[model samples]
Target: METMTTSHSLRSTSINPANLIELELLSQIVTQKQSANDIRGSIPYLAKMAQIIDNQRLETTVAASSPQQQQLQQQQHTLRLLQADAHRQLGQAYMKIGQYIQAEASLTITIQRLESLLKDDNAATSHSIIVNQLIEGYDLLKECFELLGKPHMVQGMENRKRKYTTPAPAPTQATASKDKSSP
Candidate 1:
């Protein structure tokens, strides 16, 4: 009975299909079966998964989807978070093969997704985590631009890092007094 219960729990916690695909894609890259010239084979599949997850979320928001087909709320959130991470990994794969342009594009998409998430109301509790991801994305992206010999492109990423990670300065005493008097 104990062994049967353990097996049932393991089966219930099986990996997601989309995540399984993503893991296989990453393995291909790691094993050198996928290269810059042929990343097309993997990217489109991952992109489709991301799109499906996104559309599923939208569907749930506007109307009831069949509960049998619907992803759980926690699953949806986890998948959305992984979407950004997968792109970042893809960008690294591109970088490894010296495909700077593709690397830049993939990392930029990752940064954009991370930034968008930061704007969500629920992101408050995870602000530091998101900011760290953004910083890492920007750093990798800057490396891509540098390798591509576009020093100018890196500057923009640097600025974004500063903007995202730096806190605004506190008001000085003079400014605080002026605001107090005006009100």
Candidate 2:
């Protein structure tokens, strides 16, 4: 696993990177650790990555309506998603480590963050990615509720999960044909 050698180097170096490489490396390490069932080992890395993402400042010098500003906004949105993902992974790790309360907190934050992102009209991020993250968050939250012995919350999470996992109603043949004919 990459964690064997890279983990040591990651720990030795300060992890404040202006680029995404460190974030990607941290994510890889977290995934590797989780795959090896080393949930505890991944927690600190996940926490660090989340912190780094949350603290990153976008320093765009252009006007708000400029293309550079738009790109920076997109980058900021992506960073927000990445931060939410880090929290989701941390929640999953906490759940595996039998820390239900911490898991619940992290998962709740992940869901809230994604939900807000879904409301952003200017978001360049795809709805499917946000929806998928929400589904995962709900699933993890369901487990947290189960672990915490909250049956009602578990059912609520299940319903919320279904809301995202359920496909949208397909267009009727008549409607499709009418639209095609009109065009």
Candidate 3:
């Protein structure tokens, strides 16, 4: 039932997250989840939740598999690290109760990043301290997000892959034909 809305890359045409068929399938699932008789759910809220669910499911699926999934997964790790630090500081706001989730999220992100780097061919790419920190954070965030049912973060990232992966447009044959005739 899960269809990928990921855009088609001619290089990797099957991987696009902007896929329409994926959206339609996800839409159907969301519609089925909430029946017509549910009086308390607002239309706007339903729409938002539907988006979140579709996004989360997509995110989880991509995170679990795909070689291309690595790029976005790295970004998520970085984000989770930052979030964990914020949670740590906030934990200071109330010393009695341990901010376990926050700290755990941060550590988790760090470990995940490390594992990713080890597994990656590009592990040699040097990064700044800030980037490193963020990578660690993403690990933590993934855990927290999973617990909170916020898996859509990964899907949101897939949406961004288009910006980084899509190649520049090549000129048409007519343009090439014109260029050859010039001067």
Candidate 4:
């Protein structure tokens, strides 16, 4: 389709066109189709977006510490998040279309990507967002396993989902009393 070139003030700097308006439009279309309950219709768009984002490359001439470089890094992070989301959406669409095999594959990819992003201490995206996405991926995968008649896989996926959703244990009463005395 149509491609738009990004204008960069730096002498040698550019982000892949696929990572810009085109991807955004595709994402919006996918969102619309999903909201309209046309999950099958959204599948192609989500898949296309995922493919495009995965192939994108960010080019920049600025120093690593420069603001321009920081901006580019942020864009890269955002693109990664979008890529994970696209897969997640694709999985959901496949599930709605009764394609459990495809759903499992896509959700697995989504979960791996989110988990990798979560491990990055410098990820610009919020931890909660990544965690929530991971939880959603696990939930979808669990459903996929159930549909595929894989009860063992379902229990494992449920445990993984709980890992993200369960709150950390509260401080012990002894620890709390010790802190009170110290202060």
Backbone collisions counted per model: 0, 0, 21, 0
Q: What is the TM-score of each candidate against the true structure?
A: 0.63, 0.70, 0.23, 0.74
lDDT of each: 0.69, 0.80, 0.43, 0.81
Candidate 2 regions off by >4 Å? 1-32, 60-62, 121-125, 166-183
C-alpha-based local distance difference test score of model 2 = 0.80
Q: What residue pairs clash in candidate 4, if any at all?
A: none
Best by TM-score: 4
Candidate 3 Cα outliers beyond 4 Å, as residue runs? 1-58, 62-67, 92-183
| Clashing pairs for predicted structure model 1, backbone only | none
lDDT of 2 by residue, 135-160 (tens): 87888899889889999999999988
- Superposed by TM-score, candidate 3 places the C-alpha of residue 70 at a distance from the truth, in angstroms, of 1.8
TM-score of 1: 0.63
Judge candidate 4 at residue 89 and give its lDDT. 77
Q: Report how far off residue 167 is in candidate 3 (Å).
A: 42
lDDT tens readout by residue for model 3, 1-183: 977665532232222344445545644543554355332232333334334322332234534556557655664544433333433323222221334454444344344444444444343453334445444445444444455556695454344334334666899999999999999
Query: Candidate 3 overall Cα lDDT vs. reference?
Result: 0.43
Best by lDDT: 4
Worst 10 residues of 4 by lDDT: 9-18
Residue range with the least summed lDDT across 10 consecutive positions in model 1: 52-61
Writing each residue's lDDT as its tens digit, candidate 4 over 1-183 gives: 956555543333344543667888988998898889888898999888878877766676645767877787667667678778878878888998999999999888888878887886374558887887788788889989999999999999999888888898999999999999994
lDDT for model 4 comes to 0.81
